[model samples]
Every structure is written in structure tokens, then in C-alpha cells.
Target: MRYTSAIGVTTAITAGLTACGGPASNGDGAQESGGGASGTIEAGLSYPLSTGFDPMITSGATPYAANMHIFEGLVDLDPATLVARPALATGMPKKINATTYRATLREGATFHDGSAVTADDVVFSFERVLDAKNASLMAQFVPFLDTVKAVDTSTVEFRLKYAFALFPSRISVVRIVPKKIVGADAKAFDAKPVGSGPYRFVSAVREDKIVMEKYEKYNGPHPAKAQKMVWHLMSDPSARVSALQSGRVQAIEDVPYIDMKGFTGKNKVESVQSFGLLFLMFNCKDKRFADKRVRQALHYALDTEKLIKTALLGNAEPATGYVPATHPDYSKAATVYTHDVAKAKKLLADAGVKDLSFTLMLTDTGWVKDIAPLIKESWAAAGIDAKLDIAQSPAQYAKVDKGTFDVLAAPGDPSVFGNDADLLLRWFYYGFWPEKRYGWTGSSAYKKTRSLLDRAASAADENKRKELWSQVTDLVAEEAALYPVLHRKLPTAWTTDTLTGFEPLPTTGLSFVDVGRA
Candidate 1:
């Protein structure tokens, strides 16, 4: 990819990755120019918080950065194959044993600086995730870490604490960093990133945007053709859509559900099948939710049909389980939440509950507020009185983390997990608490659920593991640890509808590398 500046010259910022470096390019046919055409595509991203612009605490921002030009892992999933393909890695590593594997580098692949990507760089990147100080939310998934040994300048090997079938895919999220520049503070890397991705960090103009110029000498499987990508930070959904339409911005993520249909006439819209699960979470510790009958009754009271039709504003899909319906293990019925006021009332009456009062803490952004009042009314009809507590950005997370409220209408898109229900139950469905971070611990259900999860994890046979996991899933559903609600779709758009190579990232969102000039 090459570029020459054909338009206005605003500012140019360049940073280096741990392994690779060289003279950065910008625009078409120009040195220090980024890839792609001159036409601007202002992208609008929404978040409760800035994700600190850092990976350690950036639960929401990381995905956007991952998509933009800021980061890259050793390998990336191929859109066409949905298989891990070499990005920084020279070639795919062959498993040497149950817990060991090795791979080589492409020899000349370097950070944006031109420093060659080597085995040591890969090792350093993986180890960083395990650092206790980082407490990467990603740590919960990739836990079995022994060591990343650099066999040689180009070759790296992974020695795991235990055998994992999905190790390669897991590495897809471990964005490699230059061990040299990371300094004592990992948080510092956020402001000054050293990544080998197509884009390099320029300057994070606080509260506005993060700018990146293209690397002129990127030697990867699929580097960005665009010279630069400008990520505009805007939290308002309506404003975002307006910006895109009015040409203030070229692209926006998570278009309002209702406006999706209206955009069909002119704008391009793409929906990627996602691994995300957006569901209502029950406070397992809540007295009313503690009863199985009461939980089931509450589930029955939710009219998913009405919610999807009206409350969701058209950006909704019926959820079967924690995993998206498209996921292979998602075998449950999506029709679990039927509208049955009579049945719901009877179950609540039998549970000996007079009236349930709890606050539904949901985000104020997007369609949440649009739906809160409706859901409150649904529960009220079932003899459950609920109040609405809406918060924005950090305040929402603070409350949820502290467990300061009850009956959270939480929704999330956990990156793709292994085909088992272990991570699903352990990190999410089990409910969250202050000290527990994310687990069923401190709850009455912890001991029993954890034991079953252990058995499921340790089971060697594939069929046996599925059976155990199936039992665990059913058990959690029955316990109402988190009421299964709906699966979310990753709304995306391409330069053209005929654009080829676009594929869904295994982690939940869409990958842009697969896209090409139409």
C-alpha cells in the first residue's frame, strides 16, 4: 500500500510498534501517508466511558481501536475462512505436544518503526495479559498461562499450563507490543502506543478524537488501503446518525434501531452475525429473584415479542441463551419469553410474594430509555413494581460494579468463547459482586455451580463435556441467575454493497480487512 497527500494537510503523528518500524506514510503516493482514498470517512463511536483509550481498562474502546489502525495481535481471523491467519506471525505454529506449540515470523515484518517483529515480542505481549496490575478484563478468558518462549530471533513457542483447543484464536486478541517502549507503567502505552497495526497512534486530543496516519511500509497479509481513518467520539445516537447523513461524518456504528429502516433508502447498512448476548441480568442475591418459581414467573411476564417490536426500536433479535442463536451450541428455543400474564400471575402468587420492588438500572444511551418504561409496565402487570434508574457512562459501571442497585437490565457482547458454557457461566451468568469481580462466589449457588463447571471443564470426552455443559446451562436457566433476553447484531456498513472479503470476526464484531474497493 502507498499514498500521496491529495488534500488538506492538518497534522501528522507517528508512533512505533515493538517489533516493526519505518518511515510512516500518508495519503496516496506520498511518503508518511496512510492508505485508502482522499475522501474522508468520519466514524462515530459511542461509549459510556473512553475505555481510557487503554487496553487494560478499555472494555468498550478496545474494539474500536482494534478496528481502526492502532493495534494488531500476532494473528488475525480470516474473514473468508473464519480461521486464524498469520498477521505478525510468519506462519502458523504446529502443535508439538498437548501443551506446547511453535511458530516462526515472516522475517521482515516490523512495527511501524521498522524494528523487526521477533519471537521475544510475541512472548512479551502474551505475558502482559497475565500481569496482575493490568487486570485486563480479557484475563478471565485466557487464564492458562505458563510461558511464551522465544526459541530464536524469528521463532516463538508457547508452553501452556494446560492444553487448550482454542489457544490460537485466543491469541488473536493479544495485541503485540514492543517490550522496549512499554516502560514501568502499562497505562502509559495507551497514550503512546507501540503497535504493528496498519495505523499508528498520533495524538489523543482529549475529549475529541484520536488521529492516526498510515504506515508507508506495512508488510502484512491485509493492510489497510485507506491512508488514514479518523475515529470521532460522539455519545449521542441521534447526533451520530445526523452527522453521518449530513456529511459531518462519513460512518457511524450502532445506528439507532428505528432509523435503520429509514436509512435503507440512501445509506449503506450491513449486519454482521455476532457472538454477542444482550440479556437481562437478575440480582441472584435479591430475595424475590432467589426463588426459582418467582424467576420463572418474571421470565414469563416479559413479552419479548412486544419488546422486540416496539421497545427495541427494530435493532433487536430474540435471544435463546447467553450465546447468539447463530452459535452452534445455542440449541434452546428463542421463544422462551412468551406473553402470559395469567400464567405469570399464578406463579408469582404461588411463590408467596406480595409485591416485588426493585430498580432497573439501564444505560441512558440508545434505545434503553425507550424501552425501560415499557418493561416496567410489563413487570407491573405481573404484580412486580419496578423503578427506573438510568445512568450514563462511568456512573452506570460504578453502580453495577459496586452492586449498589438491584435488577440490572444489563446487556453485553462477550467475545466468542470456546464451545463450552464454562466461561459463559463463570464470568457472566453467575452474577457479579464487589470482591468476586465476576463469579457466583458469595452467592448461595456458587459451590454447586462451580463444582459442575469444574466437571465440565475437566471432562475429556467431547460428548460427555457437552452433556455436562448442557446440564449446567439448564441448571443456570432454572436458577434464573440471569434471565436470557436477546442476541445482538453487529451493525456495519461498507464502501459499497458489492464490497467483497468482509467477514465476521470470531470475537463479536466485523473485520474491515476483508472489505475491499467495490
Candidate 2:
């Protein structure tokens, strides 16, 4: 109340191994049992360990999911609802003034290493993120924060540069970490994280699995329900389905759309419409895409509805705005890219463009691969020649960050961090994506977006904030530089009889904070 708040590989062999309850190989190529000690929640995760477990810098889906269990922010979002709630703190930070906040640590809260969680730890956690040298992924989310000071051992004070209406919930972006541990060896802390959460980091094998045990010292609202958790990094879709069907794992995330019906009655399979989306981003500096009309034409060219039906099996909604229609700050954009091949061609012709041809780079995620051909077909229908270059996420992003790619189709869900419209919008438009990734910082439109977002962030009136956000929504939509093609449904599968209190999340990844083995 206070919170008020992939791979496939040798399909037959992997499936057969999991089905036989045999040991699975981790990223280290070491054999480990899919089944762990009693009271362990075994899950098959679709992603491999792409990043480290440090909450401040972790961007990979799998590691981010792991951090949800291994760490805690003073105010954490409810795993299922995305509503802000007190975790390490006693309650929501008390608003001291228009630009200041104060929060008290929960009594007796201790880090997994048995160190008491102090205000200094909280201050350190924030300063590191605020410091540009750390290059934390979270710094962009808290641009209004001016400083964080330890008011006392148990109390932390936050001073913001301006009044931010969402400060209470937005601070959930930074997870509290022990100063002694992280300050001693930052690199070691990244590899093996320590936090004051329900779970303690036991071990992690890059590609194979991540093991965590319930922290006996944890005394929080959501204490661990299971003694241990073993997350199998099974990038292959078949391995995940097989692991779930064979009872080798109690739950699995990213259930392949094609395999949804197969687990109908046998397992509880649910597809929750999520903010997660497949977005199309372009290199604004490219000579061909330098014109905004060229960007708009590409969006109009795509038959999104047909792509959803064919590639996604009708499991996604065409993008009507920057955020999905289900989002709380939903506002219909000024220009929605509905299918119109004629309009696409006309826009291209008006822009004085001819023989538009470029390579469209994309990730090799199962659903993305499925839609690649359809995307190409849709563009081809509009007289555009798009060469497909599909690879794993890291490789594709490597090329993108180097500014060597033309267009990229990638899956992104910032909702996993927080669900507010400002947060979601800023994730792309405000920081790294525009400045570096897509090369849109030089555009006048980008400056306008930044101004509108800053003004909205400081707006005290809720309605006024929404109004500004809506303006941004329209502007970004019309710009069409980096926009969503469709918001896809996240499918998850689990056995109700084997695990109690398990529910599919509307965002990416799976949560088991209060879940237990039956």
C-alpha cells in the first residue's frame, strides 16, 4: 500500500537429454544436473548469459532477470504489476521538499555477505551511477538527481536538480550494493554480485547456468520461498520446451509461439501482451536515410498486421504509438504507420529518392528470424531492396555501435526496469540510442524531444506531464527514426502442480520471488 504504492542445435539430442533427466552442459562445458537439491526452483531460460550480474550495467535479458532476485532497490517494483513498493527501505522515500527526498533503511537488513545495509551503501550505489566514468546504464534514467548524501547510518537523502513528480518510483532504477564489497574490487563484484535481497549469488557459468541460494539472513517483505534456484541457460527453443514438458524444469520463459498449443492442457501456457517490441532503427547519417521522408516511407511500407499474423502467429499488436496502447500513458500518435504500399511509394517518390537499397541488420532471436522474411517481403512490395543480415544480438549491436549498419530490427523491453512512459521513452530517445547508436542527436527533432522530456519530468501536475509526454509520442512517431513495428506478446510456460504461486509477467523474463516448489 505504501508503494502506492535459439538454437536448436541438435534438436533431438538436447531434448532427449532433458527428457531423460540427464545432466545438462553449462557454458563452461561442465556437466551439471538439470535437477538440483530439494526445494530448488529449476527454470529453463531462453537467453544465455550475455552480460554480468551488476545491476547498474547489466543489459542482457538473462542477467537482468537474475539481478531481480540477487539485488534490491530501496523501492522495488512489484514483479508482476510494475508498481513501486518498499523493499530495502521502510517505505517510499518521504518527500522532504519539491527537490529532495529521504529514505530509511529497513531495520536489520543485511547484505548476502552478512554486512549491514547502511546509508553509505545507498549513497555509494547512486554516486557510482551518477558518475559518468562508470558508464552505468541507469544514469540516463535519473538525470534530475543532483546528489545523494548519507543523512545518517540508517537514512539516505536525495537532492534533485529540479522537482520531478516521478522521483519516488524512478529511483527504483538503482539497486543498493555494499560499498565495502564493490569499492574493494569493482570487477570482482560484477562477476559475483552481493546484495541485500532474498537470494544470494552462489555461482554462475557463463552460458550454462546461474545458481542462487535463499539468503537465510534475508528479512524482507518477499523472502525466498525456495531454498535454491538453478536457471538453465538453454538458448535453444526445443531444449526449453523439452525441459518443461519432461518435468526437468518447473518453469520456462520465452516459450516459442509455435509451441504454445502443444503445452495447452499439460502445462499452464499464457501469452501476456507486453511492452516488449520489435523495433526498426535506422542510421540517420546514412545519405539515403538522411531525409525524414525516407524514414517515414519505410514505416508505411511494412504491412505490420500481416507480419504479426505470419511471423508471430497473431501474437502481437501493430505499433500505434511509441509505447503500446495498453500502457498507462498511451496516446495515439499523429502518424501511425498502417500498411499502405501506395503511400510508401509516394512518400519515397516525393522525397526524390530512387533505387533505395540497403542492408537491414537484425538479431537472430526466434521470433525476429521468423519475421525477417516477412519484413523483407513487405519492403520489397513497396519497391525497396533490403538485404537481410541476421546474427546474434551481441554481434549485431557491435556493428550498430560502430556505426556500420543501415537498419536494425531488434527486440527491446525497457519495461523490465520500470513501466512509466517517461522511463520507457527516455530509454531510447534521451541517451545512448540517439546520441551514439542511431546518430539522431544532430536532428532538430531530437533536441525538441529532449526539451519536452525535461519539461515533463519537472512538471508537478500529472495531467500536464501526460500532455507533454503525448506531444513527445507524436513527435517521435512522425520522425520515425527509431520506432516500434509491433508490440509482441511474451509467452511463458510452467507446471502449476510443480510450482506454487507462479504467474507469467507482462514484461520480458520470469520472476519467482514468492514462488515455491510443491
Best by TM-score: 2
The TM-scores, one per candidate, come to 0.83, 0.93
Candidate 2 lDDT trough over 10 residues, lowest sum: 1-10
lDDT of 1 by residue, 147-228 (tens): 8888989888888787765566666656677777675655566556667776666655433554555565677776665555
**lDDT of each prediction vs. the true structure?**
0.58, 0.85
lDDT, candidate 2, at 276: 90
Model 2 TM-score, 2 decimals:
0.93
lDDT per residue (tens digit) for residues 101-214 in model 2: 999999999998898999999999999999988877788899999999998899999999999999999999999999999999876787778999888887777667878877
Positional deviation of 206 in candidate 2, in angstroms?
A: 1.1
RMSD, one per candidate, in order:
7.0, 6.5
Q: Residue 196 error for model 1, in Å?
A: 0.7
User: Which sections of candidate 1 miss by over 4 Å?
Assistant: 1-40, 62-64, 78-83, 264-266, 333-335, 416-426, 429-439, 442-445, 452-465, 493-511, 514-518
Model 2: how far residue 324 lies from native, Å: 0.9
